[model samples]
Structure formats: structure tokens, C-alpha cells
Target: MKIFNLPLSESTFEKRAPFYGRLSATIEDMRGKTKLVLRLLLLFVAKHEIEATNWKIIALWGMG
Candidate 1:
């Protein structure tokens, strides 16, 4: 098996490394924001359901 050595410049590697690092960090930040939004949405839905059930109970009791 022949091993092929790829030529890479020091400056090119350095620039690309930092660029990829920043891109990865941005992706992580976006994921965190998405998770937070999903959690908030779930909490809001749960609260809305609870309030709806309570209103239904109140209406039934008032009618009787």
C-alpha cells in the first residue's frame, strides 16, 4: 500500500481551523436556542391545557 502525502500550507491550515471552530460554535449556539424555544412552547401548551380544563369544570359547576 502506497501512502500518499497531501501537501498542506501552515497558514492555510491555521485559517481553516479557526473558521471551522467558529462555525461549530455557531451551530451549538443555534441548537441551544432551539432547545430553549421548544421547552417554552411545551410549557405554554401544558398551561393552556390546564386552564382550559379548569374553565370547563367551572362552567359545569355554574350551570348546575
Candidate 2:
């Protein structure tokens, strides 16, 4: 992830298998605890990869 818009690490972009499975678990966890709008906003701002190909990130608070 990027720190102050500076390049961070290459390992951060490493492939993660079964992406949907892990993602589903997280969604279930936040289903009732957090509102949908808030969750979407958080996800949008917290972990944005400006350069998708490079997997560079601009994580603020990160995933819940």
C-alpha cells in the first residue's frame, strides 16, 4: 500500500486465491453492524489502488 502517495511494497499485490470466498465472509461480518452507505464509502476511500496494474494502494482505514 502507498504511504502519503509514495510507493510502498510489491508483495501487497500478490495474488489472493478464492477472492470471493474471503470477500463474502467480510461482507457477512459487516452486514448489520455497519450501514451499506457507510460501508461502501469506507471501502471506496480506504483501499483504492490508483494504478490497478501496479497494485499500488492508497489505504486510509483499510477493510473492516
Candidate 3:
């Protein structure tokens, strides 16, 4: 992926440590049930809230 002319490779994405180490660690330490809740919370965003219909909209909304 390219971000502002900076190239980011697949391996960079696979390793979340540099970007989200603390949040990742917190998620990792959660119980199975808690993890499930977290996943649900993350996936439960209302479509209308984001209004993302395509990749471009999704990217713009995500960045904004």
C-alpha cells in the first residue's frame, strides 16, 4: 500500500506492533468472551454512520 508516497508492504501490515502495540496487547490479554465482545463492537458500526459505499469512501472516511 502507498501512503503519501511512502510504500507500505504486506509484511508491515502483518506486524501490528509498530502501529498498535498497546491496543493489540490489551486485546490479546482479554478473555475469550471479552474478545468476542470486542469483535462485535468493532463490526457493529452502523452503515449510515459511515456512509461508505466504495473503497474510496471507506478510505476517506477512515482517514478523516
Candidate 4:
């Protein structure tokens, strides 16, 4: 899933899968949510890997 990028166990991911689906009933909103999550993850990863920056991330995964 293009949902979260963190040290999450299988149980935790599966536990929240239903809620992720509940982000929206429309296909467009769901897709947007996925893309937004991925973009945020890419930014976080790039900041740490490419720029050699240190970040302490505390994430709450959901639709705003």
C-alpha cells in the first residue's frame, strides 16, 4: 500500500486498512489521498537521504 512509510508491523497496517478505505467513497478522493501520502513520504525520504538531513517524524496517517 502507498499509505505509510515507517516501521509499522503487519498487524498495525492491516488494522488500519479499513479506515484508509474509508477516507472516501469516491475513486478520485481515494486516489488523491494515496498520492498525497506518497508525496509526503518521498519528501521525507529525500530530505534524509539526498540532503543528508536528520528528521524525527511523528506521523498520524489519515485523510485531513
Candidate 5:
């Protein structure tokens, strides 16, 4: 007959595994979201500048 015994106490790393995983996941998500927002903001600014430049050109043409 073979007898097996499970661990009665958690190791230090095991005890902290969930906390570390959550922290790492949160950081990764935040970094991805930040990058996405920054890209969107940059695109919006570029679009706004293009529209403003077009308006300026139209105004200049009207004056000439």
C-alpha cells in the first residue's frame, strides 16, 4: 500500500501567487489601455489640425 500526504501549509511563494498575478495583470492592462488612449488622442489631434488647416486655406482663398 502507498500513502500520500498533501501539504498542510502553503509556501511563501504559493501564498503570494494570487496577489502577484493580480498586480501583474493590472499593470499590463493599465499599460495597454494607456497606449490605446494615447494613440487615439494623437489621431484626434492630427485630424483636428488637418481640418483647421483646410479652413484656413479656404479663408485665405476667400480674401484673395
Candidate 6:
């Protein structure tokens, strides 16, 4: 992946720390367990609401 002209290799993506992945995994895993995952979504949204955007990390995952 390329972000801000920086090249990101597969290994770099794979080597991301758990801090970058755990909540995302939790969100995916929670899918289908409940008819409405509003609470889970709220948690995610609320987090992003409070924190500053880290485009480098988001782009590392090909997101944002």
C-alpha cells in the first residue's frame, strides 16, 4: 500500500501492533451475534470522536 508517498509492504501491514487491530477484530467478530450492534458501533464511533485522526495508521489498513 502507498500512503503519503510512503510505500507499505505486506510485512509492514502484518507487523502492525495489536493496538491497531484488536478493536477492529472485536467489531467484526461481534457481527451477527446480535440483531443490532448499535452499542458496538457506538463504542467505535465514540472512540474516533474523541481521538485525533491518525491518517498514517488508517491508511496502513487501507482505510480512510
Q: What tens-digit string does per-residue lDDT give for candidate 2 at 6-62?
A: 224554433443564687789988876678778888878665643552453334325
Candidate order (TM-score): 5, 1, 4, 3, 6, 2
Candidate 3 TM-score, C-alpha based: 0.27
Instruction: Report the number of clashing residue pairs per model.
Output: 0, 0, 0, 0, 0, 0
Which candidate tops TM-score? Answer: 5
Every model's TM-score: 0.69, 0.25, 0.27, 0.40, 0.72, 0.26
TM-score, cand. 2: 0.25
Q: For model 3, what is the alpha-carbon lDDT of residue 20?
A: 67
Query: Which residue segments of model 6 deviate by more than 4 Å?
Result: 1-36, 53-64
- Model 6 is weakest, by summed lDDT over 10 consecutive residues, at 1-10
How many Å off is the CA of 54 in candidate 3? 7.7
Residue-level error in angstroms, candidate 4, position 29? 0.3
User: Global CA lDDT of candidate 1, please?
Assistant: 0.88
Once fitted onto the true fold, the runs of candidate 3 whose alpha carbons sit more than 4 angstroms away are: 1-30, 46-49, 52-64
Q: Each model's RMSD to truth, in Å?
A: 6.3, 23.2, 18.6, 20.5, 9.3, 21.8
Cα lDDT computed for each candidate against the true fold: 0.88, 0.58, 0.67, 0.69, 0.89, 0.67
Which window of 10 residues has the lowest lDDT sum in candidate 2? 55-64
C-alpha positional error of residue 34 in candidate 5 after TM-score superposition, expressed in Å: 0.9
lDDT of 1 by residue, 1-64 (tens): 7574333888776768877789789999999999999999999999999999999999999999
lDDT of 5 by residue, 1-64 (tens): 6364434567866877788799899999999999999999999999999999999999999999
Model 3: ten consecutive residues of lowest lDDT: 2-11
- Write out the backbone clash pairs for model 4: none
- Write candidate 3's Cα lDDT for 1-64 as tens digits: 7544422777766675465667667677786679798778777765534555566687888999
